[model samples]
Target: MTVTASDAHSAVQTLTQSSDTLFLLLGAIMVFLMHAGFAFLEVGTVRNKNQVNALVKILADFGVSAVAYFFIGYWVAYDVTFFADANTLSQGNGYELVKFFFLVTFAAAIPAIVSGGIAERARFYPIMLATFLTVALIYPLFEGMIWNGNFGLQAWFEAKYGAGFHDFAGSVVVHGVGGWIALIAVLFLGMRNGRVKAGKHTNFAPSNIPFLALGAWILSVGWFGFNVMSAQAVNGISGLVAMNSLMAMVGGILAALVAGKNDPGFIHNGPLAGLVAVCAGSDLMHPLGALFTGLVAGAMFVFVFTYLQNKTQIDDVLGVWPLHGLCGAWGGIAAGIFGSEALWGLGGVSLTVQVMGTLLGIVVAVAGAFIVYGALRLTIGLRLSEEEEYRGADLTVHRISSTSND
Candidate 1:
């Protein structure tokens, strides 16, 4: 018949819990749509004969990551206490809901990146297995540290150096993971066939530039949710975070337009580059600083991808390394440079911490990716059989599956 004051407070907390759940769901939807953007971009970059396979592979990766990670992968990463000062809903099984929502889309992205590199090749099963491993094990380690602090790299840095690294969203965690994985995938799979056959069109042009344009635009749009909403606890920096994201995009696009010789292709990549570049600083950078950071990142991808393709043998499929990996690194560094000491009383973050974060991220991401892919190549093998690679994955994987129907 009587209610205690504790009951009143608990009821209010319960209501707040519902509100957080709704917001988290919204962010999840926005992030999931980014996967669609990746799909369209992959389709635009790959050969037409492989179109069905591209969409199918992406769908499969999303489905696989969702189910596998939810069941066990989330527990492994968040359970270990990757960060010390960072938030971890609880140990063992407490953080499942939050970790699940954040990681599903990230896991989905790895396959999309792989789709570009191993396009027109790679048997369905091998790619699926590889995708599951990367998302299930590789990615969770990175995410676990950043969010849960169980491993406590950030804590160690803060404890030893009195400064800490920050990733406003996940320039390193999400994009860097994908980029590094993409690099390894291509290395193992080798270049696409006819990519360098003498006298052939080695420089495979995008089949649908318009699609690239639209997808790039969508990626840029989706990034707002990726960054602004990432301040999950709401320490009062969301507005500035959103505005900085917008500014960076604008700056990135303009710089790309100026430097890309009026190529819309350059422009599309520019916004993407800008988004990648500003990710670390989305919560910290001043508007002008964000713009500059974006500009630099945009310019790098415009030239870097072209130069790499011309100079090296790595056909990154859709420039994932340059756009996400390289750009993401710059974004992280930009945060320290742009971050003021005043926001959230978090104080001015040091450039040393930012740069260290960037460097550490690059080494770990690239090496970790290479190791997983190499082991797979050595063990089960990462590439498809020569005949399967030539014939296309859709035909190889599906023709057999559909034989009963016909």
Candidate 2:
């Protein structure tokens, strides 16, 4: 049989498409595993009585987030929907569907971040409702603005500044937004019962250090897929992103070790803080720049977490605000700095634009959180009763403990 040029071209296209599809699918699967990291992280940090609730909340939030994002959030962000027939949806080897899967994992992370902050005190159903609202509506608004270029926000930034805001992997879009929103949810829920006594913070050490370490390890491993695969295509992948992510992780570990006074929790979270910061610039930075960014983020998490716990009444369990929110913001700004060619980076970022973009993310997060959590607080209540709290959410909500003996 003779093959025509058109047929040959078509065959090559099909092969490329199939390869890209498989690449994205693997990336999506790796990110999907991060949810287990979130679950275990929360489980280990909260008291033993609340461990089961922590595990349940992460999984439930992911389920709700998938539904919300599929039906609503994807449309809001990319102006795309999956209402078509299966054949139509599966045209590109289901690449688009896997893309949605990858992104929905990010969307689900907002509620998981909030889960840690409000754990042990929040009611289950209300939190689920909040997750639905946030993933379906609030998160996608900013996500569209930055990622999809939906509202001309990126054009405006480029017009005013030399370059548009450049968050290659969602330092602001995901981590920053999640962290700030978690802060507000934590505030609305208030401190857990007996967390403070007469204006003095009480010590609530982690329930399981091994579990905490395991969670951190899982997140760290999966983060390679999270940052590297943001390219979304086989042709677009870069080793630079992988390298920067590694340097930043080590920087965070070492900095946190020194700054956190060798605390195990701080040590574990240090790498996360670094990873969160490097996400914005992983593709643009020199490895050394990423290292410095990680160092700053690691130390910042320890210091800010300590300050918030000691100096303020904000009872943010697991310090999501410090780890994700503030470090995420730093990552955004650091991209502008370390991503500049002057600093041995790839360049094409404007520091001014990054600052503005970072602040905008924070504003959106704070306002959206207030609207969602505040409404929940006023209408159905956001917290468990004091009696329920003392009994722990595992018993009050799930009717099971982490361990049982017959």
Query: Top TM-score: which candidate number?
Result: 2
lDDT of 1 by residue, 1-406 (tens): 7999999988877666666655666677788888777777777666655666777888888998876677656776666323343445443223336546765776677667667667777767777887777777777777777766757888987887777778878887777667777877787777777777674437777767877777786777788878776875434338878888888898889888988888867788888888888877687777888888888988888888878677777877778888887888787777877785653323457678878877776676677778777877788876666787676665666653212332
lDDT of 1 at 283: 74
lDDT tens digits, residue span 1-406, model 2: 9999999999999999999988988889888999899988888899999999999999999999999999999999999999899999999788898899889988998998888888889999999999999999999999999998978999999888878889988899999999999999999988887878887888699999999999999999999999999999999999999999999999999999999999999999999999999999999999999999999999999999999888887899999999999999999999999999999999999999999999999999999999999999999999999999999999999888888941
Ten residues in a row with the worst lDDT in model 2?
397-406
Q: How far is candidate 2 from the true structure (C-alpha RMSD, Å)?
A: 1.0
140: Cα error in model 2, Å: 0.5
lDDT of 1 at 240: 76
The runs of at least 3 residues in candidate 2 whose Cα sits more than 4 Å from the true structure, single-residue gaps closed, are none
Best by lDDT: 2
Error of 1 at 127 (Å): 1.5
